[model samples]
Target: MPIAALSDLAGKAECPLLVIKVGSALLVGKEGVRREWLTGLVAEIAEARARGQQVIVVSSGAIALGAATLGLDKGGRGSLADAQACAAVGQIALSGLWAELLGSHGFTAAQMLLTLEDLEDRRRYLNVTATLTRLLDAGAVPVINENDSVATQEIRFGDNDRLAARVAQAAQASAVLLLSDIDGLYDRHPKEPGARMIPVVEGVTAEVKAMASADSNSGMGSGGMISKLQAAEIAELAGICLVIGNGQHDRPVARVTGEGIGTLFLPCRKASARKAWLGGRLRLKGSLVVDAGAAAALERGSSLLAKGITEVEGVFERGDPVAIVDGAGQVLAHGLSEYDAAECAAITGMHSSEQAAVLGYAPRSAVVHRDQMVLK
Candidate 1:
């Protein structure tokens, strides 16, 4: 689809719930937070809300804002701690700007900072979801950003693009609008000749993946087209449409919503909220090695059993997350463990009926219940 065609489709989408992810590059220009751009973006969001559309803003610019405020040179970070500190300072200023901007339009904005852990834990994920839903119900636009100041690399989403996708999934939003410096995904680097724009990506095929490059043109942001595609994949799985375009475009959201410009990636399938959270949110803690027959059954969407368990690695206690590994040691999926490390080790290769006899007490009916499992 061409940009014009996508814009037409976007306009025709019914009661679309929008998730707008504003990149740091557009938020902070060479000087600092471009007040004109920020004001314009907020006005667009306010307008969308007035039209009876629910809008969730996933914004990035904390570190950049902090750097500007602290007079630190861009890209002069000496350590992760330094970047974290910058994010801390920047987040405060970022929230203030959003509050003031939205307040001018007689709309209230609530700040939500989340780390990957919040999405990884089932309880925390539900809590965050409930909070956002209530805020939306109350007609307050929620401004979400990663808790970068306190997030470690292991628990970080690495970039806001991915974070936005997860947020879209969590909020069950209809579409995710990735507002960035670039217009859309191109056949090659847009700077290169003959690199045409790809208007609609139906799915992330191998061909589409090949076209992705990790080059970053935005000085204030970490992600590029590659990260955006990854985010799109997550959104697609969650049954959310995604639009990627230049945030610099005037009335960007309205334009994208009303026959503007961008690449639209349609949804492939819709995963239920519980399934989406289980499949895409939680991070695995350990692995459970199963026999070949067990692997085949699991591949066919069957639950894992103790009879199939040949070995268990890592010291995960009951309820801890663990990857279901095949006989060859390839990870097939992830699920919560029903038994502790010692219990699993003792019951390995035992029949289902023998579980209680060997362990003295049965942990659960299955080693990894299908309900808790998610294919990788």
Candidate 2:
């Protein structure tokens, strides 16, 4: 298929939520912030906003800028403490520049610092999603960066590429644009003779992954081509398209706006916000084995009832994710269990009316409500 048109895409139903990730190399240089590039980027942002699009930027360069300000080697020989110090100082520089530039374009730049926990925890995830939505509704562009000042190796996203994917997924963005030093994905390293750029990737299969195996160090940014591909995989599963393109060109955003300027990774399918959060992209805590009748009901768009469950496997509390399977061992749907395993065991095969009698209280009738399930 021909690459999707960016202008046409910007008019889609979900286009209001567009996430653009700017890499460190493009945003920073030996002198610190790249002024000319920022001006061009701001112009694009102005155009996008005028078109009624709500833009979110996942930006890198905090540590690099911080290191530069401290007279340290960029992205090299920095201890964790030094890195954290750099981030603490650099965030101010980054956000200040963004605020000033965006303000010049008659836009407000809202800064957000995030850690992996913000996206991993259920409560925090909902909060982040709500905040982003509210910011967009209020006509402010949110520029997010990882909270490197406090993040340790074990808790860090390690790269803004994956962080951007998570942000796009949670924000229910129509698409993600990754503007980097390189133009797009290639058959092999672009530095190698005869290597060809792959204009579009419909799926991230094993073959597609193999092409990204080479180390991705851009010298200034933490992510390489491998990280971009990994981020693409995350976006694909969340049903969000991802675009990777060169951000060094004049009118960087306009370049990607044209046809074939980048590699677009199309989503496998569109998934609803509720379904994506319920269990479509999560790890299940347990499973419910139901009879064929219940499986058929599920396929017919019915909720999972306690009376339909034959067995429960694994230990899980109420509100935890669980897999629903058929008697023949076919996975049907994934959802949050309304009751803990103990309560479920007591209420198994019981009618809805019997739930309160057996468990002393019934918060909900369905073991997994239709609204909380995503059919596999």
Candidate 3:
């Protein structure tokens, strides 16, 4: 069957790494864990593995499982302590189920619990990325989740939708599947009389974002359409494709990929080696704002010169990832800064020939060399 959306990228060779996000409501309910659904999902994952596809799962439902098992009263808004307790208790059961299901298919399931801070901190981010890379290399499925048990508002993502996007970026996944309750994004609420599902989104525009609803049908899941769109934007920025589809169908994973029964958010474009490296950076040290002329030059694939820089924000060492914004505050690109922040400050607006007189050094003509930059 022809892919429903993103037909250009339907082939197996196009997607080497696939990250799938499973919503909580589909996995847990008042009746408890959904065994039949889990079984089908695991079979789909196994089939992908047999085809040499690398898969990672970012799953939800720990709190719902914990709440049900502990018999917690859920009649009103729950306290942080209650949520934390539920997550702690529920994570065990959730991980166990994944392990058992995958093990039955003769594949190992490794659990990875992470908080927002883990990804924000450069060191911690690299460490986690290394661990995930090792696990995937060993032919193990890394089942990841937000560390909800200890994640407070200060360090919490509030939902796994955005977290899954981050995981996809870190793992360098080509495609991500968001298995939600709904089949795809609609022009209006799906239940409304004249709602229409948008099959393909080449880009996330203001009009497209307006189509999403903030409310979710599942009380067990934290993310709604708004968060999923935010995740899609994130994935798009990182040059990764994302599909949002319903998890209720049989072989949902396979169908979404092969038949395209979902809304596919295409990336801006395929990333070159340098662009991919720059786009995947989780931590950026600073930013350099340039004039419109410089922005235009960069867009035309020209090198950035010191004379083009208008201002610098934040302290950054040489070789750190830095944002390159235009005069209107639009992010034009991201690249490695050739000079330190202090040097950049001293040399801003100076001609290339004048750099030696100002700093007694001119490492290169460009503040951010063309070879190191990725235009957004």
Candidate 4:
């Protein structure tokens, strides 16, 4: 189907929940918080909530506001610690603005800052989902942002675009609206005369990829068109439709929700909840190397058998997450290990049928069950 048609269908349907990601560029201008733009966005969100549709906002503006407030040079001359400190100062002001705007509409806004580690652990992921679900049920809008104040390079979400996609996957959102400075994804940078908007993208193909330009010259923020495309791919894999459009447009959320603007990316395939969690949520703690035949079997959707194991690296408990690597040292996939590191080492190269004898107790036939495996 054409993307416009799909967007029309989505807008007309009674979508239960919507995830909107507002970029920093739209939130902060040369002066300060773009009150006019923010006011419109809040109004739209309020309208949506009044219609009984839940909304979760993944917003980016802390660093920009921090830069402005501290009178520091934008996007330069700041160490990681400096930026973290700036975020710490700006977060308070940012939340205050949201609270005031939401308050006028007879609604309340709650702040939620997350790091990569929060979603990497299974228990934490479940807890986050439950909390957000409860907030939505209570008619409260959750304003989410990356925990930049304490986040290090190792545990950051990298960019708000990807973070928004992950949030949509965790919340099981119906669609993700990525509001940016640009109108939509185009054949090239929109500044060029010949650049044309590609309204519908069936998939992220090589041809579509070649059309992308690495022209993220924005000094105020890190994300650009490339990051937005990556977020679309992530959301598509998780069976959620994604739309990228200009946040500066009047009534941005309402316009997109009404099928009047932006580029729409259709979902390719729907992944199961367990598989999606296994694929995107878990952080790898160790790796298991396998031979070519074993890699082939895994690619064919088979489970990891002990006979195919070659070696293990790193220390991980039985329920810990591990990476499946090929003999050449390329990561094939990730899964929760069924045995401890020592047990897996002892049973390497043994037949799966003999697992019970080698370990003195068999847990399951496969080392990594098919249901627990996600192909990378």
TM-score, predicted candidate 3 vs. hidden true structure = 0.78
Give per-residue CA lDDT, model 2, range 1-376, as digits (tens). Answer: 2225554445535476689999888888767689898888888888889888789999998988888888877463268888899999999999999999999988999999999888866788899999999998888999999999999987878889989998998888878899998889999888889999887788787788878843554678888889898788777767888988889887877887765588888876655766665543434678899988898999999999998999999899988888998887777888888899998888888888878887776648698999888876
Q: What is the lDDT of candidate 1?
A: 0.82
Whole-structure CA lDDT of model 2: 0.83
lDDT of 4 by residue, 290-349 (tens): 989999999999999888999988899988888999988877878889888988898988
**Which candidate number maximizes lDDT?**
3
Ranking by TM-score: 1, 4, 3, 2
Q: After superposition, how far is residue 182 of candidate 4 from its true place, in Å?
A: 2.3
Per-residue CA lDDT of model 3 for 1-376, tens digit only, reads 2223544333557776888999998897668999898899999888878877789999998988898878887711188888899999999999999999999999999999998878765578678889999999999999999999998866788888988988887787878889989999999888999999898898788799889998888766889999998888778877788889889887887677667678998876656534654664445789999998898899999888989999999999998889999877878888999899999999999887888988886557688988888876
Candidate 1: regions farther than 4 A off? 1-5, 8-15, 187-193, 205-207, 258-260, 289-293, 307-313, 325-331, 341-363
Question: Between which residue pairs do clashes occur in model 3?
Answer: none
Q: What is the lDDT of residue 122 in candidate 3?
A: 58
TM-score to true structure, per model = 0.86, 0.75, 0.78, 0.85
Residue-wise lDDT of candidate 1 within 1-376, one digit each (tens)? 2222455324324535678999988888887788998899888877777667788999999988898887777642546787798899999999999999999998899999999999888899889999999999998889999998988878888789989999988898877889988878888888898998887888776688788878878766888888898888788777777888888876777666566567888876676677677667536667899989999899898989899999878887888888888877776877888888888889899887877888887557888898878765
Q: In order, what lDDT does every prediction score?
A: 0.82, 0.83, 0.84, 0.79
Global CA lDDT computed for model 3: 0.84
What's the true lDDT of residue 43 in model 1?
A: 88
